[model samples]
Each structure stands twice: as C-alpha cells, then as structure tokens.
Target: MRSVLAACLLLGLAHTARAEAPLTLRFVAPERYTDAQSRTGSGPTLRTTIGGLERIFRDLAGRTLHPGQSLTVDVLDVDLAGTDLPGAGPTAPRLVTDVTPPRLRLRYALRERGRVVLAAEETVTDINFLLRARPGGSSSLAYERDILAAWFGARIARREPPRG
Candidate 1:
C-alpha cells in the first residue's frame, strides 16, 4: 500500500511539472521575416538567429510566468538591432545607430489554468536601445534579448491586459 501511494504521488508531481511548462513558440513564415538573417556573409545564419530568439523567449517566459501560467507566441517578424554598413566587407560589423533599434512583431496569448487571460498582436521596439544599459553585454542576440525582456516585463510580468 505504501509503494502504491508513493507511485501515485510521483505521477501527480510529474503531471504538475508538465502543466507548468511556460512557453509555446511558433515562427510563422520564417522566410518572410524582416531581418532574421545575417547581414554579414560570415555571420550567423537565419536558422541561428531564429534559434537564439527561441531560447530567449523560453528563458524569459520560464522566469517570469506563474507556475500555472503559460504563454504562446507566434512570431511574425524580426528586425535586429542594427543595419549592416553599406559597402562593408563580409566580416564587417553591423552599424548600431539610434534609429536602428531592435523590433519584434508577434501575436501572443497568455493563459492561466487553460483560460486566456491576455492576448494581443504587438510590435515591440526600443528606439533608445543604444542609450540603455544592457545587462546581457556582448552576448549573442543581446540587443534583441533586451528588447524582448522589456516587452515581457511590461506585458506578462506585470499581468497587464493588452491595451487595445
């Protein structure tokens, strides 16, 4: 009887853990994304950029969401932080200017206990990205990650419903 009870308890715990999984990410028409590919010929490819974004979303949602909450993100477009300098070589760095901030267009649904609490199609950007202090300094997709973090904080962490 003790072993049976323990087995049932373990199964219940496993189910709860699975229920608490945080994020579901979908890339809609990735090939049509605005700037998901590497501008420099020698830099990370489109696949790499998308993969990095996925990791960022998962990490952010995991850390910010409540245990019984989950977020579903459908990525519609991505414009990275900078533009490649014109006539630059294949290995040249991108030009990070005040105007060329990171942008992400996505549709998201935040659910709690299988009920939709918030949903929106949002275009998130940080025009002052160059002026802000980036905590994840020099990391891959750092600028993009920062903007996403800000978006997550405003939209999900605060539990604010969509404005419009």
Candidate 2:
C-alpha cells in the first residue's frame, strides 16, 4: 500500500511539473504607411520609405519578448496589391500599386500546436508611435505577445523570472 501511494504521488507531481509545449510565430508586415505627411499645401507628387516603420516593430517585439529571450522572427513583406487610387488630376484613371511600392512591411503572428492563435496589425507612421501599449503589464494591447510570453512553453527569457 505504501509503495502504491508513493507511486501515485510521484506521478501526480510529475504531471504537475510538466509544462505545455512552446509556441512560435512568424511576423509579417500589415498594409499601411510607416510614415506619411499630410499634403496640406501640395507641391510635387511624393512618397516615403518605410524603413523607420520596421524599426518600430523591432522595438516593440524586443520589449515584449522575455527580456533577453530572442524571438525567432520570419518577417513577410506586407501586401498592398490592387489598391484603387486616382492621381490628383482629373483624367487620371485608377491605379493599383504593388504592396511593396516603397518601404516593406512584415506580419508577426504567434504560433503553438502548429497554429496561429493570436495576431495584431501595426503600421509605420512618420509621426509618433505606430501604436501605444496597454496600461500595466497586462499586455492587454496585444493578446499574441501577452499570452504567449506567459503560457508559451519553454522559457525564452535569459534573465530569471521576476520574483514577487
């Protein structure tokens, strides 16, 4: 009886110690401008590169990830194909420009069990932060980042978890 009870206890402890599998996600750029200026007083037709926008994504991800835990990012360029636009002229017909007309964009999605459970869209803005983070450590702003980091299997953080 003692051995049987000990065996059951060991099994229960092992099960409790087990962690869920880790999740992975591929990041991609969503359609939109990294930065754009209003044409209040028009001059010449113009466009801007999305280089600054990519930097914004990198910054956000870096902060959300487990401290030093480097995230594996597969950045897919944003698709802006078949968008209708008529030039500032009267006779100009609608034009469909390639999504990668200028600066490139990428999408970031969280994955686990070989599926994407959460996602978010971010565009590069010339002005200020493309998007703001939620209040506190709720990670409420983004479900993908918040949930995955907390429950995602395998510790990604290089530093020790914060002790309460």
- Candidate 2 stretches with Cα past 4 Å from truth are 1-49, 80-84, 89-164
**lDDT string, candidate 1, 1-164, tens digits:** 99999999999999987786778899999898888776556455689889999999998997899877889999999988787665566555567778888889999999888899889998888788877746548765888888889889989999776566
* Candidate 2 per-residue C-alpha lDDT over 52-93 given as tens digits, one digit per residue, 9 for 90 to 100: 323444555455554223334444443221222333443222
Q: What lDDT, from 0 to 1, does candidate 2 have?
A: 0.34
Predicted model with the maximum TM-score: 1
Query: For every model shown, what is its TM-score relative to the native structure?
Result: 0.82, 0.26
Output the TM-score of candidate 1.
0.82
In model 1, where do residues sit more than 4 Å from their true spots? 1-18, 39-42, 86-92, 162-164
- Each model's lDDT comes to 0.83, 0.34
Clashes of each: 0, 12
